[model samples]
Target: MSFTTFLKSVPAFRSLATREVERLSSQCEPVAYPQGQQIIRKGDPGDAMYVIRRGEVKVPIVDEHGREKLVIRLGAGEFFGEMALLTGEPRNADVFAETEVECLVIRRKPLQDFLHKHTGVASFLTEILGRRLLEGDGIRTVGKYRLVGELGRGGMAHVFEGLHPQLNMAVAIKMLSHELVYDEEFASRFREEAKIMAGLKHENIVEVIDSEEAYATFFIIMEKVVGTVLSRMIDTRGVIPFDETRRILSQLASALDHAHTHGIIHRDIKPANVIIEESGRVKLMDFGIAKTQKEAEQEDEDIVGTAEYMSPEQALGRKMDGRADIYSLGILAYEMLTGRLPFDSPDPYEILRRHVRDEVPSPKLLNQRVPDDLAELVRRACAKKPEDRFQRCADIVKFLQQDAPAAIDLSKARAKVFTVIYDPEREEQVTGLFRRALAEARKIRGARISISDMNRIY
Candidate 1:
């Protein structure tokens, strides 16, 4: 049979126009795998979908304990990896050649482009995949966890409350958005997020229990915290009391310290990512754009963080470390104390520019009730230079543990001061000179400079 004829018989391509099918057939690359060879491995990034032309393959589902069970077998004309191709999710199962096999592989981009141009085929494929996710009773499940209710939705994924029938335990199931399934970057980040969270086991950090993929979509199972997000709490109560803020910041700091020690950096840290349980325990969640120390070093410079809470380095798209998280925590601390962000603007770029150029205003300036020492702590944490900020979250915790007035000497904390004398008459020239000097000084961690008007001083 002609390649186009065979493609027309495939369920996904059945609805496509003859020319569409011909276009897809022209893009298919045929390859063969010997019997006993592994065709696909679980957790590998999916790049293409395949249609069998000859022979057979066995699909094996592996359990948590590393045991594998043969789930299904496929023969000539059957297709596999369609879900991964459509969703950009990792392969969920291992496939082995049951016999010498020949497959016509359709690469991801062309197929996606084809689907984009043909909405009917895309919808048809979606309906077929959607049916595969539903059980006999009409309950939708990812692995063994059945989704019960939607907790929330974000740009990357939708969070659902789920229950495991066998385990009889409830969990928060985070499913990648279908709209983002074809976005390779988002898909990779979602998969890495699961791995990062699964490795971390801290009481103050939301625990990741498991991750699964069904019908080419990824789901992360996490412990459900019964509490409100810190953002909502701040919105409802305005300013949190100092004692409550201290407790929340301390717990959150410890969680961050733990993650940092493990070489993970939580790039997106904001009030919205924190949860305050009914018992007053703090649970830090969301590590979507996180990276390991090594990964950060190798990563291309891309600004990825919450604008208002971003560190100066992050705002400039520079490489960052755990200090970035400490800076964000400082912003969170400021919000908790003053009932407002240290920097706020309608335009995100303006906010990012402010993070890079302006000094964080003292929380005490906004709220008179803020203790001088505590306000100093927030200022240090949100310093324009990462080196000037608290080097570690553990240090933040230690500062919070001590009696603020006795533990911190305000004069010493502000001791590093540089005097820059510029002529007032040549204001434009002075401004340009100051910008150059400031840029150079920021390169040195913990370096401080104070500008003075030469006209006023002289």
Candidate 2:
């Protein structure tokens, strides 16, 4: 398989684009080992993880008396040594090749360095580690809901497919992890999201059915959706068709428009959180992490959302609004059209920096099939500054449907275009010309610009 294809084969790595997988592949060195060779020893320092290209490796359990017992067997495509990467701990178990093995080995320092920089990778790792740290067996129920099956888990919560005892309605129950429930601040945030979601009622969005703390566990129940998430669809299809992308975008924009009208900001709008029904209908999920207008104002260092889809303000940990969601939707729109994110890095921190400062290349540059108008819309939506982007979801819908009127060019209106000259003699004239140009531009826009610029146009 190709390098990118190999990475996508791993469930955790599927969300990453081909270019990102290529970059990661560069850090890995191919190595081989023969049968019975000890690859990792218990208590040894771990600074690297290896993905098996071929052969089998067995993790053995050893008693204090040095008796060995076979615990689990890992084969081609499986990874080992992540415990060290996640927790900085020594190897917990000894791994020996059960057969001749070839693997791609990525060293710890380089991997951790990359992980520290990329928010998406960090979020993925958190989910993986969270699962490992929590019960591997899993919880069967929470309060009134009897969990029929597990849906998914993240750093702070585990979701289960469940049903209410009295109502018998199908529901998805999200229980705050026991380890996190004790954190008053985190619990408050969780509760706040529940309350905010409870207030919203929209068909395009998942409905929050109920929330409560029972038997020391905090859980929220939402309408269960038996459909595939868009991210998984992207993984299987590589790139979504423009028509389908447009359809999904329209539905999602409608959902956001409704939520924004209700004063809620999704804060996270990646493909992973969008569900596509069997009938091709869209249902936006995971309001358990959305922020409200009131909550958005609180100053805190805590950051949320998958790093790849974060708006500039969200990545910077600054206060956010509905426009932040607009920016995130732009990123998703880009991915839907081009099959990749506009910005990527081995360091997620750089991704945040770029979101706040870099320009998003047009979608047509990556995919010839993307129409120029759609590409331009994506560019504007993903603009670095909130004021530079489409101000609302309604604007996006109107643009997509070709019903939008001649709209304001927010960038020129909000920006000062200075014409600098070397001649010191005409300073006053140049300054006067600048004032006249500014005045005319403002008059044409029908809005007063509270901007000040000394330089004038020629």
Error of 1 at 396 (Å): 0.6
What is the lDDT of every predicted structure here?
Answer: 0.81, 0.76
Clashing pairs in 2: 47-108, 117-347, 117-348, 117-349, 118-347, 118-348, 434-456
The window of 10 residues in a row where model 1 has the poorest summed lDDT is 118-127
The RMSD (Cα, Å) of candidate 2 is 19.9
Question: Which digits, one per residue and each the tens of the lDDT, describe model 2 over residues 1-458?
Answer: 76567766876566556666676676678899999999998888877788888899998777888888547899988888865654466877888999999988878677656643443333334344444434444334565576676778766677877888998888987877643554556667789878877887888888888897753447788999888899998888766755567778989999999999998888888998899999889999877568777888775487787788888888888888899899899899898888888889998888888887887888888888776667877888888888988998998888887822245677865644554654779778877887787645533323435555455565
| Model 1 C-alpha lDDT per residue in residues 73-189, reported as the tens digit of each score | 999978888766646778888889999999998788776776545433343344345444443534367788887766876656668788977788989988776545556677788
lDDT, model 2: 0.76
lDDT of 1: 0.81
Once fitted onto the true fold, the runs of candidate 2 whose alpha carbons sit more than 4 angstroms away are 1-141, 298-300, 403-458
Specify the poorest-scoring 10-residue window by lDDT in model 2: 118-127
How many clashes in each structure? 1, 7
Q: Which stretches of candidate 1 lie over 4 Å from their true place?
A: 1-137, 404-458
- Give candidate 2's error at residue 94 in angstroms: 39
